[model samples]
Target: MDEHPEPGHDPAVGALDPRAELSEFLRTRRARLKPEDVGLRSFGRYRRVPGLRREELAQLAGVSAAYYTRLEQGNGRHVSAEVLDAIARALRLSDAEHAHLTHLAKPKQHKKKPAVRTQQVSGPLRTLLDTMDGVPASIVGRRSDILAWNRMAAAVFGNWAELPAQEQNWVRLVFLRPEYRDLFADWERKANDVVCQLRLDAGSHPHDPQLSALVGELSVKSEDFRRLWATRDVTVKCNGVQRLHHPLVGELDLRVESFHLADDHEQMLLTSHAEPGSPSAEALRLLASWGTDATTAGAGTPPTRTA
Candidate 1:
């Protein structure tokens, strides 16, 4: 046994029970839908259960009530793909959500001992980060870890390179750190996005002990995280505009873009760029020029004199 486990791998975090996860995911999805939302007539009848009843969902998905009930109970053994698709349609799940559903219903076989390797940034990838001068770019691992970043990223975002390895996760930063809450103009949106991404990861890697630990820590520390996690919403924000409030720069509206590495799908290259000739672009240039000094100033620390 590797005495020193990976940073996110806490023995006490406890492995996630996939069956329980599936049940909760199904329950939450079903709870969010109403009878009329799926074109079913409610007839103003008093309803005990929120959203669509199991029987109603079964009818919409063209499955038997008992069958849907069994699947929802986390017993997805021998479930057909077509039936899963029908259920997803009935739930009106997004593409990401549908994928999550599939993963939950038919998880891959787990090894007796799950791998606990630490993720690393390839040298070429590091060089690539350095070459992206104006664009703030970072390489994020599958577990949302900040594996590597460029100077521009440190200048525009916080100085991630200076932080301890374990603290370099997106979910932890968004939920556990007050600074991040202040950094995003719309903190709630950012929180939702991070949680949704985590949800997607959860469905795919239900047996990941590190992920289970991260979820456990976040759920205990953040009421908002607990609320968002319970929603079971899943999404991957590939392209979007993020509003930010930087300490040095007044305000910035940057276009965020993410691309999965061709060779390693588990790693994603995320970059943010401002529109050409925009004030945000000018701010980025200033930060780039100042570089480490700007990072120092951003932290409200006076530059040291070295004569």
Candidate 2:
């Protein structure tokens, strides 16, 4: 064998284990949720497990105990579609969560390695991506490539665009590279965001070789990443606050939102505010105007220098 099976080092800043991922997701989803959350209840004052017991859930899903256990253990292969549907309903899975379940239940079928969904932008999605005048937005596929970006978005995350096509994963930069720590005002919050997003991807695409490899690489690299990855939290990425530590203009509190095009696949819109004539917003405007990519269609220009 060559000196190293995979030459380049991933530093393992943060990584996820699919088996553990599936187990945690199932356990937590089963816990924390009150019976009232799903219209189930127990009479006596005694309950051994939190949330619904494993057997109770199996009953609700119309599955056998051993089967559901295997599913939660991430060892169940070739699960039936009907059982999956039952589990989805019993778990009270959201649309995104449901899609993720199916991905796990079914083995991935692809000839060449799939490109993590960087392509396949829908018409309405393209239109929405184009119209965002202020926020810097970009659509990231399952592998987290910066596929398409709006003008302001490009500026805010300029460094990502400047990177070679292959090196644009946000998680890679955050944990493996020192620059990631400097870019966010609240490192914990931003780190949490990264971890949560990665968790979501892990659940949705368990069989993606590249995705698995990327995550495995990160897990071995960074202790901080590993710790956060262990939290096992996932998000739908609908809306959130992002704190930015700009190398040029201090910090800007941004409102970030995500809208999905094809179910779980979506684009993120990152916008900063300047009160009509406020200094920060002014800075934002100046940032976009300074070195904006005017020719790029949907993404017009950055509110600031693309860093």
The TM-score leader among the candidates is 1
Evaluate all candidate structures by whole-model CA lDDT and list the values in order: 0.84, 0.65
lDDT of 2 by residue, 149-235 (tens): 666766565545567776777788777777568878777777777777766676666555666677667666677776776655565
Worst 10 residues of 2 by lDDT: 1-10
The CA-based lDDT of model 2 is what? 0.65
Score residue 66 of candidate 1 by CA lDDT.
96
Which ranges of candidate 1 are over 4 A from the true structure? 1-13, 298-307
Name the lDDT value of residue 185 in candidate 2: 74
Which lDDT tens digits does candidate 1 get at residues 181-255?
889999999999889998888888877778888887776677788778777789988589999998887699999
